[model samples]
Target: MFAAFDRPRISLRDAMAEALTKVPDVEIDPEGTFKYILVRVKDGDKQKDIVRGTKAAEYHNHIFDKVKPALEALGMECECLGGGKIEHNGKEKKIRVFGESTAFGKAEHSVSVEKLKTVFSNYEITWSDDKK
Candidate 1:
Protein backbone atom coordinates (compact mmCIF):
# COMPACT_ATOMS: atom_id res chain seq x y z
CA MET A 1 0.00 0.00 0.00
CA PHE A 2 2.92 2.39 0.68
CA ALA A 3 4.42 1.53 -2.74
CA ALA A 4 1.21 2.72 -4.50
CA PHE A 5 1.38 6.08 -2.63
CA ASP A 6 4.96 6.60 -3.91
CA ARG A 7 3.89 6.64 -7.60
CA PRO A 8 5.64 9.23 -9.80
CA ARG A 9 4.01 12.73 -9.98
CA ILE A 10 3.34 14.64 -13.22
CA SER A 11 6.28 16.57 -14.68
CA LEU A 12 6.44 20.37 -14.29
CA ARG A 13 6.16 20.88 -18.07
CA ASP A 14 3.08 18.66 -18.32
CA ALA A 15 1.45 20.38 -15.33
CA MET A 16 2.01 23.82 -16.85
CA ALA A 17 0.51 22.65 -20.18
CA GLU A 18 -2.60 21.35 -18.42
CA ALA A 19 -3.00 24.57 -16.41
CA LEU A 20 -2.76 26.66 -19.63
CA THR A 21 -5.68 24.69 -21.20
CA LYS A 22 -8.21 26.24 -18.74
CA VAL A 23 -8.94 29.96 -18.30
CA PRO A 24 -8.34 31.17 -14.74
CA ASP A 25 -10.92 33.28 -12.83
CA VAL A 26 -8.20 35.77 -11.92
CA GLU A 27 -5.22 36.93 -13.90
CA ILE A 28 -1.98 35.35 -12.71
CA ASP A 29 1.31 37.22 -12.57
CA PRO A 30 4.55 35.70 -13.84
CA GLU A 31 5.45 35.02 -10.19
CA GLY A 32 2.20 32.99 -9.81
CA THR A 33 0.44 35.69 -7.75
CA PHE A 34 -2.91 37.42 -8.38
CA LYS A 35 -2.46 40.55 -10.56
CA TYR A 36 -4.79 42.89 -8.64
CA ILE A 37 -6.75 42.53 -5.38
CA LEU A 38 -9.45 44.63 -3.65
CA VAL A 39 -10.11 47.42 -6.12
CA ARG A 40 -11.73 50.37 -4.20
CA VAL A 41 -12.12 53.18 -6.70
CA LYS A 42 -15.41 53.39 -8.60
CA ASP A 43 -15.23 54.42 -12.31
CA GLY A 44 -18.31 56.67 -12.15
CA ASP A 45 -18.20 60.49 -12.45
CA LYS A 46 -14.46 61.22 -12.77
CA GLN A 47 -14.95 64.66 -14.36
CA LYS A 48 -14.95 66.53 -11.04
CA ASP A 49 -11.88 64.66 -9.83
CA ILE A 50 -9.96 65.10 -13.09
CA VAL A 51 -10.70 68.85 -13.05
CA ARG A 52 -9.61 69.20 -9.42
CA GLY A 53 -5.97 68.05 -9.47
CA THR A 54 -3.79 69.98 -6.95
CA LYS A 55 -2.67 72.94 -9.08
CA ALA A 56 -5.96 73.19 -10.94
CA ALA A 57 -7.98 73.22 -7.72
CA GLU A 58 -5.83 76.02 -6.26
CA TYR A 59 -6.11 78.05 -9.46
CA HIS A 60 -9.90 77.57 -9.47
CA ASN A 61 -10.12 78.84 -5.89
CA HIS A 62 -8.02 81.89 -6.76
CA ILE A 63 -10.26 82.66 -9.73
CA PHE A 64 -13.40 82.45 -7.60
CA ASP A 65 -12.02 84.50 -4.71
CA LYS A 66 -9.95 87.12 -6.57
CA VAL A 67 -9.99 87.09 -10.42
CA LYS A 68 -13.78 87.05 -10.83
CA PRO A 69 -14.24 89.94 -8.44
CA ALA A 70 -11.50 91.98 -10.10
CA LEU A 71 -12.98 91.42 -13.58
CA GLU A 72 -16.50 92.21 -12.36
CA ALA A 73 -15.25 95.42 -10.74
CA LEU A 74 -13.95 96.48 -14.13
CA GLY A 75 -17.53 96.14 -15.53
CA MET A 76 -16.79 92.76 -17.13
CA GLU A 77 -19.17 89.89 -16.43
CA CYS A 78 -17.00 86.89 -15.49
CA GLU A 79 -17.92 83.34 -14.66
CA CYS A 80 -15.79 80.63 -13.07
CA LEU A 81 -16.60 77.32 -14.74
CA GLY A 82 -13.78 75.35 -13.08
CA GLY A 83 -10.23 74.43 -14.07
CA GLY A 84 -8.27 72.47 -16.70
CA LYS A 85 -4.73 71.86 -18.05
CA ILE A 86 -2.82 73.44 -20.93
CA GLU A 87 0.64 73.16 -22.45
CA HIS A 88 2.46 76.37 -21.60
CA ASN A 89 6.18 77.04 -22.26
CA GLY A 90 6.46 73.43 -23.41
CA LYS A 91 5.23 72.19 -20.03
CA GLU A 92 1.84 71.18 -18.66
CA LYS A 93 0.21 73.96 -16.62
CA LYS A 94 -3.15 73.96 -14.82
CA ILE A 95 -5.64 76.69 -15.76
CA ARG A 96 -8.39 78.23 -13.63
CA VAL A 97 -10.54 79.59 -16.50
CA PHE A 98 -12.86 77.31 -18.45
CA GLY A 99 -16.00 79.38 -18.76
CA GLU A 100 -18.28 81.04 -21.30
CA SER A 101 -19.80 84.51 -21.23
CA THR A 102 -22.06 86.56 -23.52
CA ALA A 103 -20.87 89.68 -21.68
CA PHE A 104 -17.68 90.04 -23.74
CA GLY A 105 -18.07 92.34 -26.73
CA LYS A 106 -15.31 92.96 -29.31
CA ALA A 107 -13.51 95.66 -27.26
CA GLU A 108 -14.20 93.91 -23.94
CA HIS A 109 -12.91 90.61 -25.30
CA SER A 110 -9.64 92.21 -26.40
CA VAL A 111 -9.28 94.00 -23.08
CA SER A 112 -10.08 90.86 -21.10
CA VAL A 113 -7.60 88.86 -23.15
CA GLU A 114 -4.89 91.41 -22.45
CA LYS A 115 -5.77 91.47 -18.77
CA LEU A 116 -5.66 87.67 -18.56
CA LYS A 117 -2.33 87.64 -20.36
CA THR A 118 -0.90 90.05 -17.82
CA VAL A 119 -2.34 88.07 -14.91
CA PHE A 120 -1.01 84.74 -16.19
CA SER A 121 2.07 85.87 -18.06
CA ASN A 122 3.86 82.55 -17.70
CA TYR A 123 0.93 80.58 -19.14
CA GLU A 124 -0.18 80.35 -22.75
CA ILE A 125 -3.86 81.30 -22.87
CA THR A 126 -6.20 79.93 -25.51
CA TRP A 127 -9.48 81.78 -25.85
CA SER A 128 -12.82 80.35 -26.99
CA ASP A 129 -12.60 82.22 -30.30
CA ASP A 130 -9.22 80.55 -30.98
CA LYS A 131 -7.27 83.71 -30.14
CA LYS A 132 -4.08 83.18 -28.13
Candidate 2:
Protein backbone atom coordinates (compact mmCIF):
# COMPACT_ATOMS: atom_id res chain seq x y z
CA MET A 1 0.00 0.00 0.00
CA PHE A 2 1.15 3.56 -0.62
CA ALA A 3 2.40 5.38 2.45
CA ALA A 4 0.55 8.38 3.98
CA PHE A 5 3.22 10.84 2.80
CA ASP A 6 5.49 9.06 0.43
CA ARG A 7 6.17 11.93 -1.97
CA PRO A 8 6.87 14.93 0.24
CA ARG A 9 3.14 15.30 0.23
CA ILE A 10 1.44 18.12 2.07
CA SER A 11 0.63 18.19 5.76
CA LEU A 12 -2.33 16.18 7.11
CA ARG A 13 -4.60 19.22 7.30
CA ASP A 14 -3.99 20.23 3.69
CA ALA A 15 -4.57 16.71 2.50
CA MET A 16 -7.77 16.69 4.54
CA ALA A 17 -9.00 19.97 3.04
CA GLU A 18 -8.44 18.70 -0.45
CA ALA A 19 -10.41 15.58 0.30
CA LEU A 20 -13.18 17.48 2.09
CA THR A 21 -13.81 19.56 -1.01
CA LYS A 22 -14.69 16.47 -2.98
CA VAL A 23 -17.84 15.54 -1.07
CA PRO A 24 -21.40 16.86 -1.58
CA ASP A 25 -22.46 17.76 1.98
CA VAL A 26 -19.15 17.66 3.82
CA GLU A 27 -17.49 19.61 6.61
CA ILE A 28 -14.73 19.18 9.15
CA ASP A 29 -15.97 20.11 12.62
CA PRO A 30 -13.78 23.15 13.22
CA GLU A 31 -13.86 22.44 16.96
CA GLY A 32 -13.59 18.65 16.81
CA THR A 33 -10.74 16.74 18.43
CA PHE A 34 -10.23 13.85 16.04
CA LYS A 35 -7.18 14.33 13.87
CA TYR A 36 -7.33 11.69 11.15
CA ILE A 37 -10.96 10.79 10.67
CA LEU A 38 -12.56 13.49 8.51
CA VAL A 39 -16.13 13.24 9.84
CA ARG A 40 -18.94 14.72 7.76
CA VAL A 41 -22.63 15.42 8.32
CA LYS A 42 -24.92 12.70 7.09
CA ASP A 43 -28.39 14.24 7.18
CA GLY A 44 -30.56 17.38 6.74
CA ASP A 45 -29.68 17.97 3.10
CA LYS A 46 -33.36 17.85 2.17
CA GLN A 47 -34.57 19.68 5.25
CA LYS A 48 -35.82 23.28 5.51
CA ASP A 49 -32.55 24.15 7.17
CA ILE A 50 -31.04 24.38 3.70
CA VAL A 51 -33.30 27.27 2.68
CA ARG A 52 -33.32 28.83 6.14
CA GLY A 53 -29.72 30.00 5.81
CA THR A 54 -28.42 26.84 7.47
CA LYS A 55 -25.32 26.04 5.52
CA ALA A 56 -25.04 22.25 5.81
CA ALA A 57 -21.49 22.51 4.65
CA GLU A 58 -20.52 24.83 7.45
CA TYR A 59 -22.10 22.47 9.95
CA HIS A 60 -19.95 19.66 8.62
CA ASN A 61 -16.87 21.80 8.98
CA HIS A 62 -17.84 22.38 12.59
CA ILE A 63 -18.24 18.65 13.21
CA PHE A 64 -14.92 17.59 11.79
CA ASP A 65 -13.35 20.46 13.64
CA LYS A 66 -14.43 18.81 16.88
CA VAL A 67 -13.97 15.06 16.43
CA LYS A 68 -11.00 14.20 14.19
CA PRO A 69 -8.15 14.62 16.64
CA ALA A 70 -9.65 12.41 19.32
CA LEU A 71 -10.45 9.66 16.86
CA GLU A 72 -6.85 9.73 15.78
CA ALA A 73 -5.59 9.67 19.35
CA LEU A 74 -7.71 6.62 20.09
CA GLY A 75 -5.42 4.70 17.75
CA MET A 76 -7.87 5.10 14.92
CA GLU A 77 -6.04 5.78 11.68
CA CYS A 78 -7.35 9.21 10.75
CA GLU A 79 -6.36 9.14 7.13
CA CYS A 80 -8.18 5.88 6.62
CA LEU A 81 -11.77 7.05 6.60
CA GLY A 82 -15.20 6.36 5.19
CA GLY A 83 -18.34 8.15 6.38
CA GLY A 84 -22.02 8.69 5.55
CA LYS A 85 -25.32 10.10 6.84
CA ILE A 86 -26.58 9.36 10.36
CA GLU A 87 -28.55 12.22 11.90
CA HIS A 88 -28.59 15.94 12.64
CA ASN A 89 -30.21 18.93 14.30
CA GLY A 90 -29.21 22.50 15.10
CA LYS A 91 -27.34 21.32 18.18
CA GLU A 92 -26.56 17.62 17.75
CA LYS A 93 -25.26 15.79 14.67
CA LYS A 94 -24.40 12.19 13.97
CA ILE A 95 -22.50 10.51 11.16
CA ARG A 96 -21.44 6.97 10.49
CA VAL A 97 -17.73 6.28 10.71
CA PHE A 98 -16.87 3.47 8.34
CA GLY A 99 -13.64 1.54 8.18
CA GLU A 100 -12.18 -1.94 8.69
CA SER A 101 -15.01 -2.70 11.13
CA THR A 102 -12.43 -4.11 13.45
CA ALA A 103 -11.48 -0.75 14.85
CA PHE A 104 -14.46 0.66 16.74
CA GLY A 105 -17.02 -0.17 19.37
CA LYS A 106 -20.18 1.40 20.81
CA ALA A 107 -18.39 2.86 23.84
CA GLU A 108 -15.92 4.64 21.64
CA HIS A 109 -18.79 6.08 19.67
CA SER A 110 -20.49 7.21 22.89
CA VAL A 111 -17.43 9.04 24.14
CA SER A 112 -16.97 10.91 20.91
CA VAL A 113 -20.62 11.88 20.73
CA GLU A 114 -20.63 13.10 24.31
CA LYS A 115 -17.58 15.20 23.61
CA LEU A 116 -19.33 16.83 20.71
CA LYS A 117 -22.38 17.48 22.85
CA THR A 118 -20.31 19.44 25.32
CA VAL A 119 -19.24 21.94 22.72
CA PHE A 120 -22.54 22.29 20.92
CA SER A 121 -25.50 23.32 23.02
CA ASN A 122 -28.01 20.64 23.93
CA TYR A 123 -26.02 18.49 21.58
CA GLU A 124 -27.24 15.36 23.22
CA ILE A 125 -26.13 11.90 22.26
CA THR A 126 -29.23 11.65 20.16
CA TRP A 127 -27.58 8.34 19.40
CA SER A 128 -24.11 6.78 19.42
CA ASP A 129 -24.76 3.73 17.29
CA ASP A 130 -21.70 2.92 15.22
CA LYS A 131 -21.38 -0.85 15.39
CA LYS A 132 -19.45 -1.35 12.20
Per-model CA lDDT versus the true structure: 0.31, 0.33
Models 1 onward score TM values of: 0.24, 0.26
Best by TM-score: 2
Model number with the top lDDT: 2
Whole-model lDDT, model 1: 0.31
Which digits, one per residue and each the tens of the lDDT, describe model 2 over residues 1-132?
778657785866665555433332222333322322223322222110000011243333343444546444533323223222233443334433222122221123333344345444444434334332
Give the runs in model 2 whose Cα sits over 4 Å from its true position: 1-86, 91-107, 130-132
- Give candidate 2's error at residue 129 in angstroms: 2.9
**Each prediction's number of clashing residue pairs:** 0, 30
lDDT of 1 by residue, 31-114 (tens): 211111111111122111111112232333432454445434533343333332222232443222223222221122233334
lDDT of 2: 0.33
Candidate 1 segments whose C-alpha is farther than 4 A from its true place: 1-59, 90-132
